[model samples]
Target: TAAAPPRIFPQAQHFVSKEFCQTEFGIVYPPVISVSSGELIEVETRDCFDGKIHPPPNENDNNEYNPAQALQQMKRAEFNPITGPIHVNGAAPGDILAVTLLDIRPKGVGVT
Candidate 1:
């Protein structure tokens, strides 16, 4: 049989440290990982709230206010954390960052 194809993770598979996360001001930190030109990588991204909304039993337990109030109380700096800069070796400025999605498998059961 042929060798199994390598798995690609275009998004982050887990939560990244706050240092690697981008702020709401649009400032992006250094690249987390570097890849050669034309290389394929799987990048994982965080949810908009960065997992602040927990599951039942503990979900509302953390926040006394309703969802709306809770959302307002959340800090602006802790929203929409993305996975990586994914530096492409030898890539120059103004180069377009092209990413191709190979597959997306949703974990757990939830409505979008």
Candidate 2:
């Protein structure tokens, strides 16, 4: 069977990174990306494990730790990391923000 063609968003500005993430906080952080009102943008994200839950290629690999341990560490660091708090230029307080999800393509197969 043939794979379906990937969805295309011509006007979307793409953004992806494992760097700009945050845990629960009392104050808001700065926006990672800025877009104008009504502009389309795509932000790539990883699963809650941040792509670390799976085992390494070799069972003997000492680098990989247990999933529980990894989860604990991530909780202490930053749990449930999301893409961004995308800033919409000219949007003010009490203004509504609309988000439309065009597509979601998982990167890899996993048991989680």
Candidate 3:
């Protein structure tokens, strides 16, 4: 008989949903959560353009893509909205952090 498959379990200790994304990084903003090293955390992120430029809803529309128009659409204080404010335990200013991507499943049909 074949061995049973390994059961998959979610490892994330904390979850930061897409609603947590912000346009600016500031020390004044309280962290959504604090985490220690070797811990698993999951964060939902918004696109660089904050979903304003992507998903040309109607492909059949005659309107052509305009970079200028896209820029205008972004009325954000920061050019890129980031999904963070994660407080790393023991981490301080000037300390460099390294990230290892275990898995990444990107959604939608956009290309770099």
Candidate 4:
């Protein structure tokens, strides 16, 4: 007799959601929210600034600038851009979507 086939597991789809976790000092690290076919979750992320603020390399900008203006500039570039809205093949409205966090890694917080 032939050997029995191994059990199969269903594959999960991923969706990239955005959240304004925080914005300080001209640096911004947007939140990364993920959703699968069965749940809602928040994924771990590194600081978007990566310690590149304070003495902005571009144009040698100083700290004297308005915080709001600097933040607006960051926003203009659409900082912390999200990945996607991946729709599962069979997902529909009112359907349960289970999003789970497989892993998370975050770095220093943005300093204004």
Q: Which structure among the candidates has the greatest TM-score?
A: 3
TM, every model = 0.60, 0.66, 0.71, 0.35
What TM-score does model 2 achieve against the real structure? 0.66
How do the residues 1-112 of candidate 1 rate in per-residue lDDT, one tens digit apiece? 5653334542544222334556443324677777776665554455777766534455646645455555677898877776665567887878887767777655463322
Cα error, residue 10 of model 3, in Å, equals 1.6
Q: Order of all candidates by lDDT, from best down to worst?
A: 3, 2, 1, 4
Which stretches of model 2 miss by more than 4 angstroms?
1-11, 14-16, 25-28, 56-65, 72-77
Of candidates 4 and 2, the better by lDDT:
2
User: What value of lDDT does candidate 1 attain over all alpha carbons?
Assistant: 0.58
What stretches of model 3 exceed 4 Å from their correct place? 1-9, 59-70, 76-78
* C-alpha positional error of residue 24 in candidate 1 after TM-score superposition, expressed in Å: 4.9
lDDT of 4: 0.42
After best superposition, candidate 1 residue 62: deviation in angstroms? 11
Model 2 lDDT tens row, 1-112: 5653343555666554446666544337888887887777766576766676765446776665676676566654554667676678998989987888878777666635
lDDT tens per residue, model 4, 23-82: 333314432443335553333232354223443344665546554556556643445443
- The candidate scoring highest on lDDT is 3
| Each candidate: RMSD | 7.8, 6.2, 7.8, 13.6
Which parts of model 1 are misplaced by more than 4 Å? 1-19, 24-28, 55-66, 109-112
| lDDT for each candidate structure | 0.58, 0.66, 0.72, 0.42
